[model samples]
Target: MPKESYNVIGVMSGTSLDGIDLAHVVFEVSDGNWTFDIEESQTISYSDAWLQKLKIAVNFHKDELEKLNSDYTILLGETIRGFIEKHGIGNLDAVCSHGHTILHQPHNGFTLQIGNLPKIAKIAGQKVICDFRVEDVALGGQGAPLVPIGDRILFSDYDYCLNLGGFSNVSFENHGLRLAFDISPVNTVLNFYANRLGFEYDDKGKLAESGKIDHELLSSLNNLAYYRQSFPKSLGFEFVKNTVLPLIESFDVSDIDKLRTFTEHIAVQIASALPKKSGKLLATGGGAYNRFLISRMQEQLPQIKIEIPEKKILEFKEALIFALLGVLKMRNETNVLASVTGAKRDHSSGKSYEN
Candidate 1:
């Protein structure tokens, strides 16, 4: 008989450089329905050196990145081992991880997420499931917004599931098809300007609240071609570095003003992407905590009720969903949706390393 329960740790590292998120979850299936309990969760912040390394890794050459990938895998393994020891966790099925994304240009026929080496199983002394995106890309998909599958199964009550992380992506059912795509750059750009002012991020967007929005800058940002693109598309740190930051730097405005304008830009882009019809929108991720940004979205989406879930779901939804992806992979079930990613077909996507 197929297993109906899984005890697993879902690990995630976002492009925002926020930190590594670890969630110890128990998922149970009954009568074809699934439910989950997040027993323990934590976010391990990266050191300054590591943060700087990841920020510039996108520009590293092949050989240099190869070494970085190996090193990152070791670090990732150690982190998982420590979490297990600290919590006295046992009887785990596997460690499911979305290794930090270094380069995600699927249009170029490739994507790179470091730290999925098979050695991770040896280091963590447990089975591991990871490197989930490469197969989707190989199958001619955007290899992104993989969380939508989890949404369709776990949080289907919401008409729309919007995750505001490094980038904002929304998943929803359209004509019985699951559709999702990256909406716009979120903390990836916001944190850039915030870091310029010696802060990790704009607290509640207060700094931006104090400044005036530069309409010209806002207009230029909204006009970004990526926003005009259709579903099955995604954004990465590369887009922010090569296109977004340079454009923002071209304007002669106060950093605070830039923050304000960009915040508005995010709101506008997200609002535009959502449907005008009335429905519930579940907003999660670090960006969901930004009260000001959420308010702006509420203003533009009056008909669409935006709901920020509980603390655990708000901060660790991706980790929890990634855990679901891992479970599906173990069952040899279809986890990547062709409708959402524009893949050639629906299939089970992940690498399994049994120790």
Candidate 2:
């Protein structure tokens, strides 16, 4: 018989490098319907050493990355163990981790997410289900925007589910198929410029609001080739490093103007990508908290109703969905959707380790 409920911890480290988000979630299935409760949650910020290593780890040679992977697994295991002990969280069926992404160029037929070493289960003293994206890539898919499965199952009430994290992505049903893809870079770019001004983030986009938009910069950003690409695509730190940052830097605009112009670009692109029909849009992730960005999106997408959930859901939805992914893996059910990722077919993708 299938289990009706599962208690799991979902750990996520986004490309934005904001922190590692951990959520103790309970998933329950009643009458073929699913529901989840985030019992406990918190984000553990990375130390300067770890942050610097991860930021530049992409530039490391193959051998260097392998060594860093080993070290990162240890750090990830330790961090998860700390969270478990601090919360006194018991009855954990497994720990589901979306390890920090180092390289995500699926077009090249490979992707790497660190911290999924088998030793993690030993260190955390729990079964671990992780490395969820590798198999999809092997199947010739982009292996990204994996959270759409959760949107389809857990939060189906809304017509569209949009996440504004390091990058912006949206998931929605179209003609009975779930479709999703990355829209544009978000905190990854905004926070970079914010750091230049000595702030961690723009703090509700106050800096952007204080500045004027640079039309030339905005036009250049909107015309980028990625924006013209079709679905089954995703963006990564590499895209920002190779495409976004250099383009932004080439323009002679104040930091504030750059921020503002980029913010507008984000709004315009998101609005353009959204479905034309009116429907509810559930917006979450860190960027949802950016009042200025949301306002700009609203102006561009007046037809679509935007809904921001409670604080817990806003900040930890990705972690919560990773927990759902774990639960699906435990049940031997498909957790990744081929329609969304362009994989050969739907499949359950994760490596399971017994402690």
Query: Which one wins on lDDT?
Result: 2
lDDT of 2: 0.94
lDDT of each: 0.92, 0.94
Model 1 — which ten-residue stretch has the worst lDDT? 269-278
The reply for model 1, stretches above 4 Å from the true place, is none
Off-target runs (Cα >4 Å) in candidate 2 are none
- Tens-digit per-residue lDDT, 247-323, candidate 1: 99999999999999989999889889976457999999999988889998888888989999999899999999999
Q: Give the alpha carbon lDDT tens digit for every residue of 243-277 in model 2.
A: 99999999999999999999999999999998674
